[model samples]
Target: MTTRTDSDHDFLASARRTLDLEQQALAALAARLDASFEHACRLILACHGRVVVTGIGKSGHIARKLAATLASTGTPAFFVHAGEASHGDLGMVVESDLVLALSNSGETAEITALLPLFKRLGTRLIAMTGHSGSTLARHADAHLDVSVEREACPLDLAPTSSTTASLALGDALAIALLEARDFSPEEFALSHPGGTLGKRLLLKVADLMHTGAELPLVNHGTSLRDALIEMTRKGHGFTCIVDAEGRLSGIYTDGDLRRTIDHHGDVRRLTIDEVMTFGGLTIEADTLAAEAIRVMEQHRVTTLVVVDTEQRPQGILKMHDLLRSGIV
Candidate 1:
């Protein structure tokens, strides 16, 4: 029951107008993409050394993000502040490396000053600029046009739509290189091993399954009471049943025990084989934990037996194991 005010309406309108301007700028940018963009991507892919991204002002911020995106997506790249490069950071660039310079005006003094040194060192240059006729673009082997018709800023001086266009263009380059390199999600996960994606891709059933003495295992013909004791001791809510050859034969859970009592009025007379679910869902120890979760969810079960090629139970995994591993 809050009252709307004139200021609130003005704020919403301003925000929407900004978004519309930026969206139009992106559409224009996309429409103008040509062989220059492809040439830039090819230059990066062909470079023997890393991609050295440098820029100044707001363009520098966009360049920094572009470098990060490239690095994470199979392109080895890093950012060097243009202002810092003139002082001493330029030494990080080698002849084998390729330079990607960003400048909205294409005449940024800090960036323009490094052009001659880059030429002397035989470093390849690719420029992204709002003005293709500027010196930076003239010297570049490949030039990308990121020019926008107008800024989202009300005064048309705050670099709103231009920056968005540059950032979007950077994403296009990263994703193009990602696809060109045939990058896989598993490879992406390796770079982000500390996040949830890493857990989903790198974690395997063997990594979190209960093994050795911790597994709740009972031999065929073992009494239901003894199986329940093993389940309680292992704390997995279920026990694996195996034959004399030590191969997994069936499984017994608390649910099965309850049904057994209801059907046969059994107390302590039932054997593990008498009520166990025959050949219950099993997964390979090498299977991904995320895939295990999929199987558990698809079947509406909470546990799975880890088995080898010979169908011998190696370990036991439960939904709790996946949840505790932060893979769910």
Candidate 2:
């Protein structure tokens, strides 16, 4: 007696409810995490060989992500399809390897087919499944229970709530392994040097600075007349004020000379120090080029003296220097 319109409306309501229910299930899974996760982390930490991930159907989707996270964060890993393992890919699993298997029912046939072989090869099988007493869990070296109280599916059939729990559990394993190794950001940068974080952590300020004669610099006691010529010659809009030791004493810009002329109006008589901004913005030669931009923006200036540990002027950085590097 129900109309087609009523059935369509029911289907939409059921789909929305499935998503909401599964989202809460994943939150609960994280809340229940404990020492078993530490045990999983230890297994991965001690692994000298690769993590061979295997799963069937929907579980395979989560398995691929787990393998990628593990490889990117310090643990070497790759995915092996469960069905393909029976045909020939089982050769990829070495005796020293760890096998992470995912199956919501704990009874996927393709996964179970490789159990005896994995056990015989001495591969430690780690199971992510909903059933504890299932065959896969029974044979696992470490069984991670991804069980759910109820399926988000109205008929309790589709893999909604169970899959969400499995995905979260996989994330927990990746992060735990990531911290267990004390993986530094520098190490991560080597793997992803083209990205922003990689560029900041791996590249130095010296790599982006204008060095040698490219620097806009003036000698001590130079007249404001000669300093203006140096600033224009270098085209960096400012000139460095250096002591006799080549140590940075101050900085003079077009802005500084303009302010001086507004008050004194005698460029002919003013010395470099007399009109220069005292101890103007400077950064270490080893500082990040990205941080250098913040220095320029914060001071509302365009130039900075790049100094060494001994406070000697080594180079200069202009806003355009950072701009040319595409970091601005």
Candidate 3:
């Protein structure tokens, strides 16, 4: 047995209140978007080199995420800790690079200390801060205000709403730059090769489909029993029927076997062309594996015939193939 206390109720209430405050903060941040945001996006897009993001503490975490979002969305970007910028890491910034600095107060000593070096290197700086009048904001080429009326913390000291606002603003900038650059899904997938999106975007039918001898192929005149043997041999639950010219003519699956048994007393006496489905669903070798999944799901089938431009049987794709390849 367990007992519930007043402290438990208070804890839940506090969490709900924190979420509400952060939601309001994001709403306010969205309403405060202005020309400075546009200028920041334009500056990053125009940069010939990378967008170097730097910050310290909680703001550093947000800056690292922003750099990752920017890099994956077609913009070249990386993160550098502001505290380390003074210790030779500042060499990473060049005149061709654009710097994005995050600071809630705009008075972070480590970040502000690099202002003179940034000026000397002539690297454009975009500042995200709560105080527009702070030194970092004043010296930056563009200042994005990420201010919040109050923190979600009960004491209003911890960075809660302010950090949320900064992170949302950073995402807005990354997405805006993505749209301006006309970034495509294929290009985004290239940057995230190890992710699920990369697998769906890059894996094609030809890459995973069983080809040549592995394909369950039979002549159109093959007996139903022979066709079943081929299906069992390939273990794809289906077999492809081809014409004399080696072109795909039809497909026969396990379901057809059940139906034939119900309709015909002896399916062994029937020819494959008489029982197999004619001109079944087929996909080209170059089609994305994701598209093949969609076709399989839409038709309620587990296998598909892969064909060439001439309609010749090239290969076969199965649900197991998609599952094994992680495209499902």
Candidate 4:
């Protein structure tokens, strides 16, 4: 007959203890970083072939995630289940490949069984384990100790803190290799084309802009009524006013039209040059679409004129275009 309050208190206390244990384990792993860690990074960096990550059970799950992180961050990598490797899956490992093996006890029979074959194939091995003196660590070209003092589980048998420590160490390795290769956001985007980050990084102004006949354009000497007609036809909420040389000189929007009628009381009496905003915000066609959003937000404008190096209007970009394309 435990009370509801007591049950709630116990639940919260268990959660806090679990988090604290995992945090302390990560701190210990960080302090243990030494020449072995550097050597592991160098081996992965200099690897001629892909990094093949292998493990069993919970360690296998961490190995898969680490492989994915390494591949997406610039290093070529893939995961192979250790139990499957002794079968025909060992063909996936080659002479030039680097093997990253993970195990808490450092004595996974499935992984250890392949050590002899790996040696014969001349494959390089890097082991991450809790036991530094284990067979896997002793046979590895480099060893990273992801040892944890104790598990966060009350029974102290589950792989809670150990798995977290191993995952964090794997992330450190991926990011270090990423920086070493000068991997850019653009390259990362290429690896993740279906993601939001890819859309933001790969989308250029030219890709989203309305070009040619889609552009709302009028000559500087055109009447305000004619500019309004052009803007209506293009549905961009604005019209670009070009000089005699066919270069962008100014812009006029619906806001300008409203202000003109309020101030002058006669839209027919004013020309585009007389009412248009001079030297309006413009962006190069090759600019990133994310940068275009920043410019529009900063100036409080809904439209941007895409121009070339010669300042000639090539197309127009509207807020709706960005919103429709998910660039916003």
Candidate 5:
């Protein structure tokens, strides 16, 4: 029976050893990277159809993640279970497509069984395996050697260090392809529209601004009291003061009211034009909402009027809108 103190010490030592072994494996993988890595990248870049990533068990899990990373970064890819390919999933492979197979031993029976079929379909194969001379590697058009000196597992049987090496190599390949294609953040956002980065990159001012009846508008010559009513009615803390032609001439806000009270004792005798700041901070409707946030932060304001090409007020964007849309 081991004491709790002994067990804790053993656990910590084991964890440290495992991490050190895995880090060394990654370092070795990086040092040994040669033309084969470039060859793999070229195959993926030239692929006319989607890359089908396949493996079994733990390798299969890594394959799925690699496929997702590749897809999100600009390469088209999807995962298929190696064991199920012989049943019917192999039909997904086509002549123009490419196959990326992962197996630590490079002798996964289920994966090797599909090799002849992949070759028959005239699909290019890229193998990520620990065994360089294995049948899978021998048959591959490009072989990425993910061999590790030893597993992090105490028994050196579990797929610990080898799996980490394979995953890291897969990431390297995906990022290389991403740079080769010059994939942009906006393009990455298209695949992840529900995420925070997507909101920051894809959302435009037009998408989050209040328009039509929601806009708080008061003409330039309107009385200050009436403009206050409009501002309160819209609940955006400000109102757009426009000219007779409905073009934006200025804006009045809570700050302007404070300045007005200080400048003149009797506020009731004043019109909006007497207190409003002419053509204050404004942004185009086509501008990015992230850019709007930056402008507000730099100028220390809570709202901006959205204008069109003709300098007419189209809509209004408040900081609250950005907060609600998860852009802030």
Candidate 6:
């Protein structure tokens, strides 16, 4: 156990106050949306090339995240350091690009220095800053005002509330542009093929469905012992039973074999139809693999048969298929 100190209490109070101030700043930013924001959205929506984001210091980091969000949401974008623009990296900006310049004060020396060139190159400029009347804002094609009432920092010298408002403004632009472009989840998935979301959206049931010879299949008249042998041989712990017309009749699993043995006291003489769970345990082949996982979860079953419109067994899927797809 440790003793409490007045200094620690004061520190906690100050931190709480700082958080309150920053939260209020963000709230103000959210409530202050105007036509300029819409104008910025339209500018980005009409762009033929990428949205080039640039800022200095803390704003630069936020710019990088903004660029990433934009790119992920169907708006092509990348970040360029304002500090590098003066050193011939300015060549990266093309007439087709839309530039988003960030400066909390709207007067960062490095960023302000780039305005003349952006104008000369005919790049569409959108400014995110605290002061709409600042030089940077005045030179921009559209100015997004992100002014805050106060800084959360005790010294008022550090960028706290100002940066929060700017970052929120950046996200507002990214998402607004995202909505305007009608970016779909499938489009977003194409850019994120390695992440969990990518696996969920980009990958479909067909990509991982057990087709070909790996499918555990048997005729409707298969004996329980034979179905058990097929289930064991396939290692999917299940088998699909079909009729002479190739229509799916039922599915047999390890659990069904156990239950059948309990009911008949012998697997050798029992037919698979007597042991298989009926219509309740099947899913469509065209259904999303994620949906298949949910069906398995809801029924507490591992095996599912993918059937066509005629209720014919097309393929077999197991909990392991969903697991391998990273969708479970």
What lDDT does each candidate get? 0.94, 0.85, 0.93, 0.93, 0.93, 0.85
User: Which scores better on lDDT, 3 or 4?
Assistant: 4
Candidate 5 lDDT over 1-328, as tens digits, reads 7567664667778899999999999999999999999999999999999999999999999999999999999999999999999999888888999999999899999999998899899999999999999999999999999999999998999999999999999999999999999999999999999988999999999999999989999987799999999999988888998888888998888888888999898999899989999988889998989999999999998889999987899999889999999877
Instruction: Give the RMSD in angstroms, all C-alphas superposed, for model 3.
Output: 2.8
Q: Go through the candidates in order and give the clash count of each.
A: 0, 0, 0, 0, 0, 0
TM-score of each: 0.95, 0.86, 0.94, 0.95, 0.93, 0.93
lDDT of 1 by residue, 178-239 (tens): 99999999899888888898999899999998899998899998988899999999988889
Better of 3 and 5 by TM-score: 3
Better of 5 and 6 by lDDT: 5
Candidate 1 all-Cα RMSD:
2.9
Candidate 2 ranges beyond 4 A from true positions:
1-19, 31-35, 323-328
Selected candidate, larger TM-score, 1 vs 6: 1
Residue-level lDDT of model 4, residues 1-328, one tens digit each, is 7567664667877899999999999999999899999999999998999999999999999999999999999999999999999989999889999999999999999999999999999999999999999999999999999999999988999999999999999999999999999999999999988877888999999999999899888987898888889989988788988988889998888888889888999677778888899988899999999999999999998888899998999998888988998766
| lDDT of model 2, residue 150 | 88
Model 5 Cα displacement at 161 (Å)? 1.5
Count of clashing pairs, candidate 4: 0
- lDDT per residue as tens, model 6, 119-186: 88999999999998999999999999989999998888888899888888888787877788788988
- Sliding window of 10 residues with minimal summed lDDT for model 3: 5-14
**Cα distance off (Å), candidate 3, residue 309:** 2.3
What C-alpha lDDT, on a 0 to 100 scale, does residue 7 get in candidate 2? 46
After superposition, candidate 6 runs with Cα above 4 Å error:
1-11
- Candidate 3 TM-score, C-alpha based: 0.94
